[model samples]
Target: MPAASAAHAVPPGRTRLITRPFRARRIRRALFCPQILVLGLIASAGAAPMARAQDAAVKEAPARSSVAAEIRAQVGGKLRDFYGPRGFWPVWVEKDAVGPQADALLKLIDSAEADGLKPGNYDPKGLRRAIEDADGSGDPKALARAELALSKSFAKLVADMRAPSRAVKMRYLDPEVEPRDPGPADILRAAAVTSSFEDYVEKAGWMSPFYMQLRKARADYGKTWADLPDVAVPTGLKLKPGAKGPGVGALRERLGLSPGGGYDKALAAKVKAFQGDHGLTPDGIAGPQTVTALNRGPKYYARALALNMERTRLLPGPWVRHVVVDAASARLWYYSGGKLDGTMKVVVGAKESQTPMMAGMIRYATLNPYWNVPPDLVERKIAPKILDGASLQKMNYEALSDWSANPQKLNQSSIDWQAVASGRQELRVRELPGRSNSMGRMKFMFPNDLGIYLHDTPSRDLFGKPARQFSNGCVRLEDAPRLGKWFFGKTLTTDSDTPEQHRPLPQPVPVYLTYLTAASGKDGVAFRPDVYGRD
Candidate 1:
């Protein structure tokens, strides 16, 4: 699916993605944007049945407690939606002081670092004081205020979990997308209706394997960046085999590789592996970028762990054969049978023309594919040149009357290039497959509004860059031949001078254009630059 835009600007010489304004218009803003709704009305969720107690007046038998009334006025709607009113009166309070429900909430709030939050932020002190003051006193006003605070805290915590992510709106670029905003009401409802808080927690747990890994990173390592020693990479430091420097010694201390680990072959291998994990060029050169990677402390690493855990939740679902293109990391990963099979360097969307976030199925690919010029570029960049009697043959240009994945060629000189190039008329300008062609040799195709596909690039040198966001929006594969062979189950070539070859996959692989700037690996959790500024 192409990034469903009202109108998309196609930059020069790239495979164009068209806007699906009509399709995008069908959905409402609420489909991606989530709003908070807080409400509840029951006397005592801990006491008598909610329905039976509903008929009784506040002053009557099984009376409406102060907390219930306050919660109703405030968070009752959302609360009732979450912890269902199973004929019980008050939903939060049990035995006057902060109950078991309140206890669990407090602990979760205090240990919020794994999610990139603070205990003080969620008002842990207020809660602790309330719990401490509850000394067998059945003071309705004090208990009710405490209960109201609990309701507020619950809403805040759920909202925090949903926030900084629910607010990230790239969903317009894709509609068939990840489910976001872990519906607090639904989670609370499961918890409330369950036999115990533990069962409710199990039913409503938000942490995935990805999230757990992040928590483990925080636990196994230190909590903050300050807790870990800095792996400072001094400027102009380089350590190759037979070379020695103080920086090399610093590296050993940083990695905790051993006190005497020097610039040996073994240490060089470690450096290369470290570079790979940090999304740097694994040339084993010990370059500046490698230093940056080494110096990334626990604080940033933990944030990466937590932030990407949220990003992982955005994925719609997992697949048996999955192809994940992580734009933030500028890497493409192929997973077969739910395990990583191969990885390749990639160039994602540029800062201005960002590669989109979409999930789709890779149906087929084309061999020696022609590069169809994006329409916006034709009007802005190519039209004037064509009008000025630019020779199509010299420019490696041809005209196409129609548009599709596979287009039919037309005589370039016969058409009125001026009209089409000037934006007065629509014409298809295509660059035939050659050395100059933008899409190098082949392309992996998927159907989407965003028209984002995995393909090979002529500018292969860009892959060597530490940060590789160089595309208009599509992902460019570094080793297309490898992926192509894997996809088609046969060998295909660019050496032949012929028309494009279309090869279908025996079994379609699910493709995900995800933005995970951090992930887990065998050594430890790895962090990457937040290229799209999603962090």
Candidate 2:
């Protein structure tokens, strides 16, 4: 969301209403008036250079003014807001030639695909043609068009880099977690005021270290895999050290190893490295599953890299102290002083109940927390079991009348179990705080609309699993007490038997719950399965 300071900024509607209509009238007058229109036509058609020069000398840049009118008439909204206030001046054109910024912008547009953006979306070819046209003739109209094109492209690139695109949002984004998309007016105003437009385009305030890391990984992987032929190791053929066959040759080629190498230690090491990167067991053996993954090849990995890069674009900027949960890999990283302090395996949501990408501040921790079961689970899982003669007390379940602080407890026998099971009724069900409670001992609170938080779990066995997507949207931490110590610099404990005991943190730590189906490391980008189909 935009900050309170952003609300203080002038609204686009106010500026546009004041400027657009006035510009429109000026443009109409410049076009419709016979003498001015004739001079404009002469300047554009190049029919009478002497007459055009005479007119230019008298009116001091009448051609540029006429071209500016054309530009004003051609654009609206943020573009109008951007150019109108500057007296319709050309930003990318100076002294009748395209500025260095125009070239830099074109280069950025060309390499946008490396940032997981489609370069074609910004029309680099069209922009290149416009620039050439502008530079060749130095015609005011051509230069004006070129300048407008550059700004349009720059705005698009800025918007794409700042946040995920609409299609990406539809597929992978949770509305509660979506990054704020900067308004076009803001994007342009920031660039327009910069002393070096080229530097602004390349290294804007929004580019963070993590963003650049993903970008570099994307480039590295793209180069490695882009031209490699999609060759598959023969199905059902397993290759280990001391084995010699066609499958080993294919595996070597797939991994970009020398074609002549046998299944030696070097080839086995490469296979292990590949397995580690692709989230398979690194046993130095090329098996059926590993072969299948290799067959997925360049195209598959390229798209993965691109999507993850876009995902990185939506994450919060570099923070000195924060917690990041990579939901795709089911891992958590705690950072302090902008360096990784610790990491742990975490159990995230299963495919049906996906842990969403979100960010918030961890303001407090709750000791001996009650597990408030979500309404859907109450209806779909608990009520049915209870209807089939399961004891609520045995399962540590309690039914509350309402969510209010001083609510009465509901009589379990009086409730319509059938209606609840069939979804006709709802219950505010919670598990009692104890050893058997779903929220094991403690939970970290990061207040969000989705009710997602980090907490300990009674079922610790899942932490040892390679793919630990076993929760219902909330993240179940492997070591909640360890995380607590990280926050407070001391072990957090409560002697009180009270449940849901909230303890405010010494300071709020930003927690970013992000999904990266592909992440960068020494082994390059380790690609993970899109468990929730978010990729």
Candidate 3:
């Protein structure tokens, strides 16, 4: 996630491009609207021609020839498997005309780039040409070849959109949870049996709403770049609030301020807001870094949005209840009953310990939970302090003999602190449940092997910062009790000093931890810093 480019910055007295044209209040509204409304929107845009399965005249099944059958055999893979069951007859061509399904499919293929796919991969021009030749010549072999080509192209698009390649998967690594991506063969089989292939191809009913929203966002950003004027902030120019120079004037113009005025308080406030939105320090000073980010035009942002869409394709297709913790934005979106219920700030893992992207069902919550000190933290920070004569009691820590239901507490004096600090010995250290405890009051348990879960943190002040990435691979919720109420449908409370007290939820909620550097909102697309540098 590169910083938000000057794409939003506009000349002084001119409307801010970032704020004016990119503000997609309507787009955000359409996202949660009913599916029928969304389909209507697509139809109105001339993108998807409404295709009614019942209205199309049903023609007799075409006869298969030995030559076409041989060609189908030669064209192997999912195409062959799909065509094998129904013989090598043409599905897209009927007599002398191309079917509506073929028209919709070719149109979709032409606009594949909007969905983060290469249109050339589908070879839209070649496909259209082949379909035309087959329709004109009425050659059985040509028709069979065209049929296979269309199917093959559609299958590839489905496969690509469903899941990214292994290289992309490696970059967006979520080893513990495997997102379900149906194979090409299964996709073909399902599409072959669908009542309306035209609707499936045009409306993309198979895709999740979340994915479609991002696709729409990509298209919107692409338009922003295409329509953006040739505006650029001067390179290497820095300005403070009281500064006065040609550079300041240039910055003012880029920020859509009066050209003649020096850097004023109003300009500083505007710069601060821009900096905060772009994942930079909000000190109200336009430094070189800020200028560089501003100089990066709208095209960069469009590409970033495309990558974000590609990453989101791996998330659950359609989830009713889920919590999304976006590491890139350091924010959490709580979805209940398939709609966004609430959003809040969150502290994700830092660069040293990047929070992984994975999905798990949060089954229960722990009241007055003990903060089991991570082994690395113990060896690196705690053990050294103990060796330097810091008492476990002073640090509100307890040394346990073993991590069990009822483990004996170990005597700090008897344990070899030097050995523990040197990595030769392992120890089970935990902070007792109290006001000063790291895990404040409670923690949500998803029970993953990665040992990452959502928990209340004692350092609530960190949430006020612009970028909250100060954790050890775990997510720190700003308001845990608020989330608890939403999760259990009631206020959660406990006063017991006892630790590890478990309370099961009324029902499990799926939690998806994804890293999206570029997110679409009412302000169009907001780009954040890739703290973990995965982007």
Candidate 4:
């Protein structure tokens, strides 16, 4: 009876057996319960995962956008800064270092680009190499190389910023360490040094370091004129007004003589001594040249010193370490290290077509180069001769066909050859390659559009003259063959051969043909006649 009662009252938690209807209902409830509870758990798990994924996407989107935006901003800023109204530092420095330095920098940049360096991804190392290779330190070309290297360095910095990993924040960079802002003094000095006329002044010995010292001494004497000791004016001694009395006294004292004695006798000995040391006239009286030396101050001396230093900047330091030509002296000297190698006379350009001041490498040597006469020469000289057949024949002139002519077609007959003689005509003539060519036996070319070069001349006798400015515009060397040999070495043999036939040089040698008018001397300064009237 108890077992029957237990079966009948089996609870839902521990049931062993069930009725069909009850079992069906329980199974349904089980299915329904699992469906509701499992769904809730799955939904809860999915909620966190979905939220995390969405947050990550949102964060990534902004980061990518920010990186893009920053890159764009930096690039835009760089472009703006480059072309801005304030101008760039390197450009200003270039303006200050006119002549060879400026020219050298420009050439270096151009040559680097030409040598396959990318403009956008410029290599700073390559730029530095270009500068070192083209060091025109005393040669004018040095400035050009320096400027080019600086520009390339700036470009490289900009390029490095493009990569996200390599980006550099440059806003906090130092300004003082950057290229300095040139002042009026720098501008004036640059202008004065680069002036075509200034080249003439520099060539004169007045701008030498020695001359500068003498000038300072003169100025000091002038400032204390009244305190100078007096000596007798020697017979035939001419006294110029405003002469330094104290300078005369100092001169007498240096000669171990007493002042206020016979003025002429005492002053004569002093004048002779001063003249001997100063390369001046031995006369007892001071003249313009002597007085000029005395009147120079420290500033003048510094300027002269700086001028010579600047002149050196125009030369290729290593190659021309033994160069001989002096644009200032109209004389050439060969130097092997510090010793004299040789000397020669030279003919420079005329005033109108004054030789340009520049520096560059000599790329080619022509055994017999044709004379491609310049347009200026045609207008000023050749055109008139073309009109006069007799003169044309004497000059060994010939006409270039329109098609054969470079840059422009030149018809000598069409131009008012006579009127054009006054800087009007634009026609040009060129001599065919031959023994009678104006370039003589050899010509050195640097490949400039300026049409400048150094060459030999049939008129070699001109070198013997005191003032040798007979060429149309280019420079004529007295010992051109010797110079050619010096540059080309064994390659420049009497036998005809390519430049490579001789000794193999690791690098190409550069030659700069510049027109400068000042240099230093042992005694002080030496003046040369401006054969071209460029002064």
Which candidate wins on lDDT? 2
lDDT of 4 at 388: 64
- Can you write out model 3's per-residue Cα lDDT over 1-535, one digit (the tens) per residue? 0012101000001111111122111222122113423453444445344343111211111223433454565678656665566544444544333456676777777777776579899888777776777666667677766777777877777767666535345222233334445555556655543444555566554454456777776676555343434357777666888899888877777776777988899889878866664556779888887887777765676567767776776554322356778898898877532346888999999999989977767789999999999988989999999878889998999999987878899999989888888899889999999998888988998887778999998888899998889999899999999999999999999866778789998877667788888766554556777788887
lDDT of 4: 0.42
Q: Write the per-residue lDDT of candidate 2 for residues 165-223, one digit (tens) a residue.
A: 44444222223333556666666665554434555455433444456677877787666
Q: By TM-score, rank the candidates, best first.
A: 2, 3, 1, 4
**Better structure of 2 and 4 per lDDT:** 2
lDDT to native, each model = 0.59, 0.71, 0.67, 0.42
RMSD of 1: 15.0
Backbone clash pairs in model 1 (N, Cα, C under 3 Å; residues 3+ apart or in different chains), count: 32
Cα displacement (Å) at residue 283, model 4:
5.7
TM-score of each: 0.49, 0.61, 0.60, 0.46
RMSD of each: 15.0, 13.2, 11.9, 31.0
| Residue-level lDDT tens digits of model 1 in 386-496 | 778787778988877788766677776677776776678887888888776788888888777766789888887899998899887988899998998877667766556
Cα lDDT of model 4 by residue, 1-535, tens digit: 1211111110110111111211111111111122332343345447757565445435433432332233233333333343222222123121113223223333333333222245435454465444444333322244344443443343342222111111111110112111122332222222222223122122221122222333333333334332333333333334433344655554455345664344356567565545544456667666555555444433443444334444433232111233434555566554322124566788876565556554444556777466777766677577766666644545766555442525454444555666657775454566655567778777776566667677888876777777665555677888788877766664454365222122322233334344444343344333333444433
Look at candidate 2 and tell me the lDDT of residue 224: 55
Q: Candidate 3 — what's its lDDT?
A: 0.67
Task: Please tell me which model should have the higher TM-score, number 1 or number 2.
Answer: 2
lDDT of 1 at 483: 93
